[model samples]
Target: MKLRLILSFFLFTTCFTAFGQEKKNAVIVEKGLIKVSVMYPYAEGKTFNMEYYETKHMPMVAGFLGANLVKYTIEKGIASGIPNQPLPFMAIGTFYVKSLSDYQAAIAPNRDGIRADFSNYTNITPVILVSEVIK
Candidate 1:
């Protein structure tokens, strides 16, 4: 239920801001890879431990998922497009996979263990975004 809501919100946001005056066909096509974004948003009084996320958490992710993960990119959000403005997210970690099945297969079995490790780094809940890359 919660995940569905989050995914729905992500979808809406992506469609709204994905391109600047570009048409649908120009932005997205049928054939592309699956991309997942794990976003940790910033709060007024909250903090994000970038060191732990990079050094410990992501390594564990790579270890458990192994070959299923095609590639990954980690972003530490700095600010909005407006200069000196704070970013909405603290960090965003993205993972790539060949297919939805591959993502499901790799994550389902290790969900609990992976989730448990969140306490080692962050207190804020993360938003997850799953999308197909544009061709």
Candidate 2:
């Protein structure tokens, strides 16, 4: 058991080194919560698109960008703060990024693929916000 723990610790350290231990360009005002609120129109009915986004597209984009997915939630009833309550099926994903540059680099190469994934939807907007974890 002790040997296994030591090995795990070594592997963890090695990964940090490989990924660059220095935390450069970290925003002074770190983003606390990252939320992607996708608003879908009533005309098309977002069931099919939602499934595709969850099962296929989300993993690819998040994995490609090195962001650990926090969670995905769907809003069924009337959501607060909107006059008409526009968004029907909303999906939220949270990720901890070392820096904005790191996040940008991860998504830069996969832009084309990401765009294609949302092509079927009438309207799709991907929003990213970073924040510091509060102690």
User: Residue 118 of candidate 1: its Cα lDDT?
Assistant: 91
Model 1 lDDT per residue over 73-99, tens place: 789988887887777899999887777
Model 2 score (lDDT): 0.56
Worst ten-residue run, lDDT, model 2? 25-34
Candidate 1 — which residues are off by over 4 angstroms?
A: 1-31
Error of 1 at 59 (Å): 1.5
How many backbone overlaps does candidate 1 show? 0
Error of 2 at 57 (Å): 1.0
Window of ten residues with lowest summed lDDT in model 1: 21-30
lDDT of 1: 0.83
Please state every model's RMSD to the true fold in angstroms: 16.1, 11.0
Error of model 2, residue 9, in angstroms? 35
Query: Using Cα atoms with residue i matched to residue i, what is each candidate's TM-score against the true structure?
Result: 0.72, 0.47
Model 2, span 5-124: residue lDDT tens: 999999999988866645553333344534444344343444335566666766676687554344444433345356775654344444444554666677788889778877763254
